[model samples]
Target: MIAANVSSSHGEKPRKPPVKVLSSQLREGKGSAVGGGKPEVSIRRLGSRRPGSSGSLAVSVVWMQGTVLEAHTDQNSALLLDETGNFHITGVKNIPRGKPCLSPGKYVMVMGVIQSHSPEPVLRAVKMADLSHNAAMHRKMWKYEVEDLQQTLPS
Candidate 1:
């Protein structure tokens, strides 16, 4: 069980790290052991109240190595890359309502929940913010499946 302490309220009192449950385990009541009580799930876990999440389990997404490959201001969008390759983030879909512009050359920190709908996992950005310039730590890693990437990218 991997656990890390983070202040989810973004304040003083620390909350327990969100647990990552196997989808099958969740379906089979395997998470009944976490809280020493019944598994108390928030929107970030498996609650149904949060919008744009479709009432499914949410997982934290942390992507650190990315470059802006494409920018579409008219659509308010950008493509990002990492060791795993490129992914799309669109203002129309990824950004929350009434959000600001996402410029090029900016290192973005996306705090969202991931949902797997089959072949790929989709990140639903709930809290998108910019990382401080010095906070970025880049490292070279192995390449991803290029042919598989070509299928997912926009033409």
Candidate 2:
């Protein structure tokens, strides 16, 4: 006759296994942790590819938290400065002719879709806001390009 052995501890606490989930639920939108989808706003540079677009707007490579000196435009170009450094490029595109290009030292809010290609970062300015007095990290968002600019300038 063969002897049978029985287990001493029957149902000890079962070991908990790992659970996998989507990264969007994570706190930082990273890994498997849960998070909220909140749009991020930052002071960054902008670049335009098709300046002729009637609706879309384009700006320059903005360097955040830097000084933009009021420099004179010699040949239909505006110069800007920011944390990244100095940039001399064409003024905002798709504005009525002779509209005074935005001056330096005028706080501005830039909004648009962010795009990265190869080794560069650019934002297609869907909207822009002037902020000169309020000294905050972010600025108030403005209306869409066509509706806003059209109202400001003469037709």
Best-fitting candidate, scored by lDDT: 1
Per-residue accuracy of model 1 over 1-155 as CA lDDT, tens digit each: 22345665555555443332222222222122133232322222222233342333322332223455566657655555444445555442456631443556655554433332122223444556554354345222212222222122221
Tens digits of per-residue lDDT for model 2, 1-155: 11123233567433212111111111112111112322222211122322443322121122122223553445444444433334333334533431243577765443333232112233333334455566344322221222333223221
* Alpha-carbon RMSD to native, per candidate: 13.7, 25.0
Candidate 1's C-alpha runs over 4 A off are 1-65, 72-77, 90-101, 116-121, 135-155
Q: lDDT score, residue 54, model 2?
A: 32
How many residue pairs collide in each prediction?
Answer: 0, 9
Give the Cα RMSD of candidate 1.
13.7
lDDT of each: 0.38, 0.31
TM-score on alpha carbons, each prediction: 0.38, 0.29
